[model samples]
Target: MGKIKKRLKNFKAPDALLLICILMAMVSILTYLIPAGEYTRFLDPETGKEMVDPNSFHYIENTPVGPWKVLSSVHQGLVESAGITSFLFIIGGAFGVLNSTGALEALISRTATRLKGKEKLVVIFFVTLWALGGAFLGNFEECLAFLPMQITLCLALGFDSITGVVIGICGVAVGYIGGVMNPFTLGISQQIAQLPPYSGIGFRLVLWLATLTVTIVYIYRYADKIHKNPQLSLSYEVDKASKYREEISSNIEFSIRHKLVLISFVLAVIGIVYGVIVFQFYLGEMAAVFILLTIVMACISDKPVNETVNAFVNGAADLLYPCLCVGFARGLTIIMMEGHILDVIVHSLTGVLGKLPSIVSAPLSFIVISIINLFVPSGSGKAVIVMPILVPMADVLGITRQTVALAYHMGDGITNLLSPAEATIMVALGLMKISYGKWIKWFWKLVLLWYLIGIIACIIAVNIGFGPF
Candidate 1:
């Protein structure tokens, strides 16, 4: 009992996040299982006509069994999606290995030396880079690779590790939601909503820039404070001698073998970027590249090929539980879609609030989407689910689809810093030993303010007839 208690106490934030996600999934499944009202009929997209069927739509459950069965069914598909789970595992494993490699340390050492007196500037630069990169790259994984460097830089700059955690994780999240060039979510949403592909790029660009600026300002203010208050900075507990010993113990120092590992990682990155830019490879192929790269890196580091494969496997093991949890969350989407719960939720909200004027409707839509984001973390996924409803509502309310998109972006961006659903947030919190509640207490005010700024910017943009509006 004592040993079990101690082990639980030592569990990291990522572990906690995974645990919580699992619990939530269980609860969601239970909700699905409960007996409920009769399933309602709706227009089937395939037939473009109204259909009446008991099992075809979601109902208000009065008992638990039905919902749980639906949830279980959805989970099966999500778990079977090799692309999503494997991609997550590969990224997590690569990051773990990279951190253990001391390449991150070298980068941070160089950055610290150069950024000694430019703490505020560094924060702004990184915020802008992450936001822009996230928007362009369209994958959160790209930001994940650079996160350790961001944390090291923040520590060197005398800020709390939480600051780097927030800026890097949430900054990319913000840009991702407000994506200007993203072809996946944004393009799909626009197309489904009867808008042209990349139709509102000019407007989205303005919003992205504005949101990025706001994020930079918020981080810079905090950076200035930390620059002055050394007490708040990261505790650099490892002395130079200890660091050397640790590096040596981990066998992470530069050597002929290590150099080859680094070269392999570099080439992998090149392949990924080229594939993304020129070939437009999907995420599955992108994940395969990373998996293959990790194997190559392990081999080049002098581990036997089989041992290297096992090392990657072992490193990726931690991801399995969390990926399963993510699978459950994905199942929620499938169930909601299958059950028509999504339509119900959207219809209820639109019935009550869809009649407002454009100016009022825009911000309200943003708030609703942001609130929804608390439950659904994937921006692309959420956009797909919500844009259909939001677009029609916007059209009815005399608002443009672009305005609704801007609102969705703002709401999604502002909440990333606070949502426990975000995997990167869990990773950052784990590395820093920061509690989710504590971190939120520290940054909630700033997040709220940033949201306000974003809303104001949206209003201004709408007034100026930006994008489709």
Candidate 2:
């Protein structure tokens, strides 16, 4: 027993690459055990995307995945994920070039000086802002653009790197759960369920407030502890390099070139956000903006052509590991889909939930969505895939469609924290150099708390008849 406890304490997360491989291999095995099944797919009139028809469930002949095919899926995943993989590369390279300029550190130095004594207030403002973004706008991938900057700020503000990364991710994550007006998750799910647009937002707003407050306070408490006792941080050992940053002296001037590059980045981010929300730009377009920003930064700095090109290339190269991890993660989904077991798993899980009591079924719906989301992480995509089946299932079980949507929103939101298959989350971890194991160790407590609150909220929503149906 003592030996067993020692082994458990010493366990570390498998590297990102190995974790994806293990999961992919596990999923391949499941294809054999779970019967092959499928639901008919049709285009959604509103979203102009293909959606599974809930009533179209049917079992087909088993399509067992072979070892050779499973091995081949690694390549297939990269091919399928080419678009996102490329976008991640550009994101890394863009930030890498910016880091090379030392602008973020300079800016953090200035900002940290102003907030010298108001560290808790600083945490509250940024965490709330990001949470609002996730709750109101479905801002998951877009939020990744801000983590590196936040890491620098957190370190400068006397917090550890984990605190920096958490501040960036946790709020948006909570907001994803609250999902007040988030189009990607709740909006699409509700619309598919044939409910009123953004119905039950009053309750959602309350959830958003409650969740945001919990996360903010949680992050602050952690920040306060680590700020005083730096040794207490999970990232403390690896953080020394980032923690004891060379203090930027107040008298040292930020050069004109640094200001130009920094201003261009800020404007570029604002423009990208507007383009994404208003013009509906996606991964490809976002990549273009960063590519453009890289050129602008290079030119404005008046550096030699060789230096600029080298910096851009090196920056992109630095992100190679995370980008490959995204490909492998995408491959896992490909293998499942190729083996024709994706629908079967969904069918199996929902069938079990459909038999439970309404209150129990409602909370289990959250768990089911969370499971499926590991295979399908895209917000709107998951909504399209699962909501069709879950919406109707909820009806027969006497569960509200609004409640189902809430479950999907909350479940999907929470899994994004731990899903290595998620592109932005992977890169966000890459930014901090934190392994998945370390993150899980530190993060599971907050997630457990959120889980409790989520179940209780779902019960309340069901009791009070949350819906426009």
Instruction: Give lDDT tens digits, candidate 2, residues 1-469.
Output: 9999999989787877788889888888888888888999998676788999888889998888878888898898889889877877787678777877767667777777778788778788888888888887677777766776777778777888788778878988988999999988988888888888898989989988888888888889999999899999888777777532546556545788889999999899888879878998888888899999998887787778787777677767867877788888888888888889988878888889978999899988898888888777888888888898888888898888999999999999999987877876777666667787877878888988888888998899789878875
- Candidate 2's C-alpha runs over 4 A off are 45-47, 242-247
Summarize candidate 1's per-residue lDDT along 182-298 as a digit string, tens digits: 665565556656666677777677777776776777778777876687555432242111112222122234456656666777898788878987888766777788778776666
Candidate models: Cα lDDT each = 0.61, 0.83
Q: Tell me, by TM-score, which candidate is best.
A: 2
Badly placed stretches (over 4 Å) of model 1 are: 1-85, 96-102, 119-122, 152-160, 227-263, 303-342, 422-424, 465-469
Query: Clash number for every model?
Result: 17, 0
Report the poorest 10 consecutive residues by lDDT, candidate 1. Answer: 239-248
Best by lDDT: 2
Candidate 1 lDDT (Cα, 0 to 1):
0.61
